[model samples]
Target: MTFAFPRAVLEQHTAFLGKTGSGKTSTAKLAVEQILAANPAARVCVLDPIKSDWWGMTSSADGQRPGLPFYILGGPRGHVALHDSAGKAIGELVATGDLPLSIIDMADFNAGGLQKFFNDFAPALMKRMRGVVYLVIEEAHEFAPKERAGIGAENLAIHNAKKLATAGRSKGIRLMVVTQRTQALHNAVLGSCDTMIAHRLTAPADQDPVKKWLKSNVDKMTFERVSSSLASLKTGSGWLCSGEAQVADLVQFPKISTFDNSATPTDGDAELHVQTAPVDRDRLRAIIGDAVKLAEENDVPRLRAEIIRLNAELASSGASQTVAAPQEEIDAAYQEGLWTGCIPSWTCSRT
Candidate 1:
């Protein structure tokens, strides 16, 4: 059965919670496809905290056709390098620019770096957005954890998440909070969601949020029926409960249009090999140049700035030649930072 998403469901804040191999991400991707199909001009931004399969959005389900041209920022497969400091700038860019699908793939970052990025990003994106924007926060629990270590960044992150839950609707921010561990996430954030699509959640703790949701939205008998079935729901199937959509149904998601790069390989499967769809190199490079500028010190921005300065100088001198910055300069800057051990902000800022 094909699960349909109403605009009421899409525009309002929603939570997608499930255990591993339960097809939560794929279900979210189905929503994305539906949204984009409904409004091709809709702005969508995905923040994948790890080396996730969101890159599959660039390829068709068959891995043969060109899918959406989502500009990826940082990862082993990213076009632009990502840094913790870049969070503030990236968030603003997503809000202010007319860019295409933007995916912030922070696979290279550690736990401390993730906290720093979320600290800077959540507030910036929340404040800068003026139009209707759809933002997907994968691994939402990590950014808005129930247990924080009393770190300022972690506190700020949860603060911004709570604000996003409470105030983001009036500001035209459509959010999807996706996580495997719903109990680990902030209650206020999950509770604030108008809709919750929960797949198979086996653990009692993990099923707590859905239980709370069901109890509040449905009759006692209905809630009991749904709660009992939480652990045995089929893969790709979920209970779509939403007050706004007026939906409470067991739905099955259809096949996604994009490649499923996140699928686990079985023991008998051959070594995985994939070839993503094609893109315009020149155009993509131009877009990546803008994303590259989001990075701060000891990064590509300074080097690019120096190259621009040299190009302007050449132009003023009536010279037709322009040159890129030397490799030695970038190498020297990186080496200096490495030796000094100075990037303290991203290393967790406890003091």
Candidate 2:
């Protein structure tokens, strides 16, 4: 089962909400793998607050090409361990200031001398790569709660996460927030996300916020239907709601058996199944028409690229944006007669 999200919105960020054992981590892992497969240049950082699901899902380094580098951010002696990146000691990550103290204290992970390490090491690591960085945070609510959070040290992880959400886009950083308590999550995180994978949510408060988030007139009945679907969803099925697309989808992941001895799930496995209404033809045509119009106008790669990007977004979510193409660009296209250029080429010419 292949599940493709709108790349445009997906580039910004994403959030996954579900109960434990609801396959949130598995879904997240599959998403990461998919992104990596698309772009091998993708760099990722996984912060497992409890150090389980995300940590163990990496390939080992062989005598040949090195495997992906995996690091554990919080734990005793709390130093970073190099799995695929050999020749690197665990002391370096511990010696760096990148580790948040708040995450340290909350997890009860004793880093010993590494306490001073992160304060001095974080800035350096922040400067390393310029490629796409996927930051995965599991049990996110503990780090960024709206109320009764721990003082300074325990809040560092949450604070850093928010900071990343606000500015990471420009820096080529993408965040994937996975949590069971969607009701307690911070809006800053959700607001920053372009795609949201909603699993089983039983909270009314949590259910209400999404309606407001999408600014959609989703009635109470639709909300309940969406929520109820999540509760009974199979391992790889859930609802995908985004600024650009909202669909009941089943994401089929790859099978894990194809890979080496790695614990990561193999490719060719279905991630989830989405059960929802059929595609609305009229709406899809309108969206396609708008995209064609944009392509005809301007004729610039950047501008046309943006239109295609938006079209994909709308296609995934089944939602349209209120922001339309600027009037000046449209007028210029018409004046230059560029508007008709793409139309004839696109028509089927069928009998």
Candidate 3:
């Protein structure tokens, strides 16, 4: 199953929407996998507020081989437990340091805590990011709601998300928002994405926005066919609506090379799949070195254990470890990769 869209979407904003169990995460991971493979120095940061198991990114498809190198933050599988107030420090680390694929698991947070964390994190990340970064926010509506009644916390969260959507591009933050509740996602945020990979969405309000976009951007037949088929689209299959590329495709995204941790588990599945692709601890340190230091400055006790753990890893890593290319070279390659990420699946034609 191969899916194609504008290759340049790597540098822009994207929205993945559908109902639950409709393959939104699968397609999102497909793009992330492609980006990492297409660009070796690729840096990705994911905010999984739902606390989903993103650690699978480091594992191979069969869970037998070492997968991509990833930094796990504040979860059951985390290198260090997350401190609630360390959001700014964490944000600054990702902004300044060179990172592999990293997931900030904020499942421990309540709504207020979640907003407070992003309140500092999102702005700092948007401000200090150096090289190109792809920011994936899963369950985006939880961050930027159309109308969530709360104190200033919810409002700030929504505003920050909108800022990421509107102003993040200049600072090299390519945002990919994943959500099942398109009806609840803010209009500004949803409308900002030029590429929309839609999965099964049966709700009328959810379909309304796609319909409106299709009405003006696509031809009448395309609008009708796509809008009518949303209710019946099969799992792991849907439409790719990119008005700019002029492609409204019926697509089944390619299978991910990594484990599908997002897949819902069946009954009696007691064996936890914490297994990830083999990890390089020294490489992981290169990404989290500054973060550990920041923890020390703030006197976060949990990270002391991490510092000791990493020291052992560094000593054991030995001479087999390799040095990465210089930052300037990596940046150049990233810019070049932006134009070629989806080239393998791409085609040019006039409708």
Can you tell me which runs of candidate 1 are displaced by over 4 Å? 149-152, 264-351
Local lDDT at 289 for model 1: 56
Q: List model 3 lDDT by residue over 215-271, tens digit each.
A: 776889988999989999899888888766768888977777787666635232522
Model 1 lDDT at residue 273: 44
The C-alpha TM-scores of every prediction are: 0.80, 0.54, 0.78
* Candidate scoring better on lDDT of 2 and 3: 3
lDDT accuracy of residue 286 in candidate 1:
62
lDDT of 2 by residue, 237-320 (tens): 666666555443445434321113223242423211211113333433342344224333444434456666776687688765
> Where in model 3 is the C-alpha error above 4 Å?
264-274, 278-351
Over 1-351, each residue of candidate 1 has an lDDT whose tens digit, in order, gives: 455787789979999989988988898888988888888888889989875658888777876666777777777667667776677777777777545578888887655777787777777878888788888889999888998876547887888889888888888788898999898999988988999998999999999878988888877876877798999999999888888988777788787888787763533232134455555556655654554544534564455566667777888899765454455554555643532322322221222
Ten-residue segment with the worst summed lDDT in candidate 2? 82-91
Q: After superposition, how far is residue 297 of candidate 1 from its true place, in Å?
A: 7.1
Winning candidate number (lDDT): 1
Number of colliding residue pairs in each model: 0, 40, 5
Candidate 2: count the clashes. Answer: 40
